[model samples]
Target: MSGVTDLVDPPRTRRPAITSLEVLCGLLVLAMLFQGRLAALLDVPALRTGSTIFVAVCVQAMPFLVFGVLVSGLIAAFVPPAALRRALPGRPAAAVPVAGVAGLALPGCECASVPVARRLIQQGVLPAAAFTFLLAAPAVNPVVLVSTAVAFPAEPRMVLARFLASLLTACAMGWLWARLGRAEWLAERVLRRVECHASGGSRWAAFTESARHDLVEAGGFLVLGGLASAVFNVLVPAAWMESLGGQLLLGVLVMAVLAVVLALCSEADAFVVASMPGLPLTAKLVFLVVGPAVDIKLIALQSGAFGRRFAARFAPATFLVAVGSACAVGAALLGGA
Candidate 1:
């Protein structure tokens, strides 16, 4: 009887593991259940300020993000990979500086550059060149330069210094990556080729799907970064900057850090740094150079697009190079004023 019962018994089924989607839904339900408590908690001055910063970052970035995805989609649909390869130099090393220079044509902020960079990679452009464009588009564009000129009307060299420094950073990083970067560092998703004509889909269909996918994937990271930036902004007192006036090295480091924490839009960061009193010109230059190249917001976006491994390596390297370039350019152009 025992043998018969054992034979009749079926294997037990395992429970399914929870997915991110399910966890997100659970969080939404929890938030809905405790909306009053959450609202009350956020009423504190610090929390309120953080919330405001988060919202402002998101609002300022969304339009540019949307524009990026749209451009990415257009590239996927219309720009043949062969044409891109033909347009650029055959060697990745040679293409790097060219891509950096091409960035001058795009007037959008960092948010707009990420998707375009990713799309360039998808379209068979080398990672080094794409990365160069990513850094340069936001920092060296005409719009950013004009804004900087307006922000520091008396110091016209500030604009030139920023352009040269940022372009130098982009090209330097590109060459570095071309020499030493490993393909395995980037996520498979970034390198994977999407079938634009899958199931005989139209180019328009491909464009819509590609844009929608990027918007959904990258947008979540953007929000996450905004939250992080907000928390950092609140924790770092504004008064701390005023006290660092005489400490050149310390001021440069702190200002560089502030650039990452603040995550200001590139078009507006010049004005923001310009308004901050007491920091030396070198420190201010570092802030301008580093902000567009390696901020908390850009880090989050890079992690989402290329994977955490890539962001971890690429972001720190970019930050260091940006600081160095800014300091050198500032000394040469501003005479370390």
Candidate 2:
């Protein structure tokens, strides 16, 4: 693969968002090559503002992207996927929380989880249990924990709140899927792709190989998402967010849209979500809960691991549950919407 292709991929396809960025970038390059009308596009204030927002999103997500890529590398190395496969809970009843707690031990992004979870399924771990851990572990890992602690410095409770909400939502969704969901909803290819590896390699080799593979894959996605989000911000108007702010449900929808649109890594989402004002605590909570389970980057990873059909069916369901949990927790914590 080309060095660029080695890095892995976004979900937003909004014309205004994606198009404006592309046009502007193309224009800038063309401007350097041709000048005149290409540079004149910036004189249109709205378009100019959009480009600025897109750039801002890209810049803001950089730290999270870097951290996620490095951590994904570590997971590919020190943490053996098989280590947890053998230890997963047997019964679906007990498996969900076990999976959620297990998240603390395994390190990776939601992207990494798809590959790892698929491995567990192949290893004969319960699908429900594996899926639960897949949803939770990325958000509850040491990296996320540290990021959460740092994001809400004004309120120590925010850290604890995020942990509790994430744990609850992950386990709850796992249990729900265990009881009512079907593994057939997942694609066969995901199983084939994620577990198709020479796992018998030495630990060091496995680590380096896995890390390099994951880093390239995840990093590639980050760059794509970064550029895309930057483009969206530049082309789209801030008024879109303002409309979302007016109604509570609308606010959550906005956050959900942002979750999908921005494609922020789960480890880094806490800070980004935490920074948005005017969004209800419940909506923000949904941002946290749904981000790890069903954002754009995650959707791509899930597609690779579970198949597009399975991911489509699974993500919306998981997202709804996470939003519910976030809303419930926000109500309890803040005493209302």
State which candidate has the highest lDDT: 1
TM-score of each: 0.89, 0.69
Full-model lDDT, candidate 2: 0.68
Clashing pairs counted in every model: 0, 13
* Tens digits of lDDT, candidate 2, 21-101: 587798778768866666675678766765675555456554444454455445545555566555765688887788789
Per-residue lDDT of candidate 1, residues 130-243 (tens digit): 999999999999999999999999889899999999999999999999998999999998898743544335888889988999999999999998999999988987777779
Worst lDDT run of 10 residues, candidate 1, spans 193-202
Q: Where in model 1 is the C-alpha error above 4 Å? A: 1-38, 195-201
At residue 57, candidate 1 shows an lDDT of 93
Model 2 regions more than 4 Å off: 1-85, 192-224, 243-246
How far out, in Å, is residue 268 in model 2?
3.3
